[model samples]
Target: MTPPAIPPPGVFGHNRSLVTPHYAMMPPAGILPSRLPGFAETVVRFQAAPALGARFAQALLEIGAGGGTTAPRDDGLEHFFYVLDGAVDVTVGGQAQRLGPGGYAFVPPGIAWGLRAEAPAQVAWVKRPYEPLPGVAPPVPRFGNRADVPRDTTNRPGRYIQFLLGTGDLAFDFEMNLMGFEPGSHFPCIETHIMEHGLLMVEGQGNYLLGRDWHEVWTGDFIWMGPFVPQQFYCTGWGPAAYLLYKNVNRDVT
Candidate 1:
């Protein structure tokens, strides 16, 4: 077998990590892995957090086979998990389910949950303090695969969206969605919205306009957009570009 190619030695190297008051872009090449408490044989890279001006935290987790939490985690926060590859067994409130690629789970606050990898696995994890609304009960745990969600293509040609969680329910304070754009497609207009967003590029490449600057992003990159920061995307690869998006909704602005 031939040896793997290596880059020529250089005095300096470049990376794609950017941060501003309005948004942040964290490329996979700039990831810094660390171990988290309660987990074994797992590495975590946090993409967004309150320290970075984000209201929530999102992390990428890489788990070795048979590795997992020592006990159920119940931290009084809502949690969302999306499997990117391999298989994982997830337990929520004593109920267990096996999640493969494209699988996702939503655990509401107060529920105990844990996960163990059936194989080497990569997962996206999001956690935030639960915001309760008067007269509206908290949402229950939800689990499903992206394949089961119907794609809504009526918005625009070459663009589609899949809502991982129900949108019509008032009990839900936030939503996670899978948005896809065929090559050469773009958002209808630059969006300047009240909702802050945590986004993970899951497929292909795109040029993202965030708060007046355009950045080239690829699969495995993560972004966090603050509220009212301008944002848009234009697909620019041979295949479709897609992202997993998180946005807080269904609550009044204080």
Candidate 2:
């Protein structure tokens, strides 16, 4: 009788599962800790890389402790924020807004925005330029929380996550989603495609395969993957691992 292959240690084992390539996974890069005034005891990062064919840009994100605030600084990219926990006061384009868990806000490029905290708050924000189409005007800045909006699943089932395609009403090269993975469940497939990704694990723990490495990620962990990086996930922590997943999807050039 033939001997069994020495599979890897993860629950999924070593053999890579292949699918129709709905999306590609990238090897996530870890960001270091930094401090800013009003943002003391906070973690900040600008996650961007050349391996993913990403143009010159930055992703300004932050996770904060109790009573932390982020002062306004200009990097000149359109800003978007999603609040993971707690509350904060955000002034965008001279307008004031209060953001709570699941909250979101957009700050126009070149516009001045300031952040202040009333309690403990955790926020994830991204900055991109307002690209113009031939005839479409740049969109007005939008602000709200995830709870205020309805969670939409994909057209097909079994992926087990809420889907929000930013391209639904705009022109872009990516689709952003809040992926909710149930504990003890499985992704079951090694996704390979052309898209790059940024996944911030908001809750729970899971074994994730990124490129040639299998990583265990928990809450407050950020995962950045390059294009065509083979990957999958299996949740194992106390609760489901909910992450904010950003994927670079091809969009029409007008």
Instruction: Please list the C-alpha lDDT of all candidates, in the order they appear.
Output: 0.90, 0.62
Q: TM-score of each candidate?
A: 0.94, 0.70
Question: Global CA lDDT of candidate 2, please?
Answer: 0.62
Off by over 4 Å in 2: 1-31, 36-71, 154-159, 163-167, 250-254
The lDDT leader among the candidates is 1
Q: Name the lDDT value of residue 102 in candidate 1.
A: 96
Displacement of the residue 208 alpha carbon in candidate 1, Å: 0.3
**Cα lDDT for residue 25, candidate 2:** 30
Clashes of 2: 6
Query: Pairing residues by index, what is the TM-score of model 2?
Result: 0.70
Write the residue-wise lDDT of candidate 2 on 113-159 in tens digits: 77766565667766555555666555556677666555554542333
- Model 1: per-residue Cα lDDT over 1-254, one tens digit each: 99977765331395567899779988876778999888988999999999999999999999998887847455799999999999999888778899999999999998999999968999999999989988878998889999999999996899999999968677888899999999999988899998889999999999999887889999999999999999999999799999999998888877
Candidate 1 TM-score over all chains jointly: 0.94
Clashes of each: 0, 6
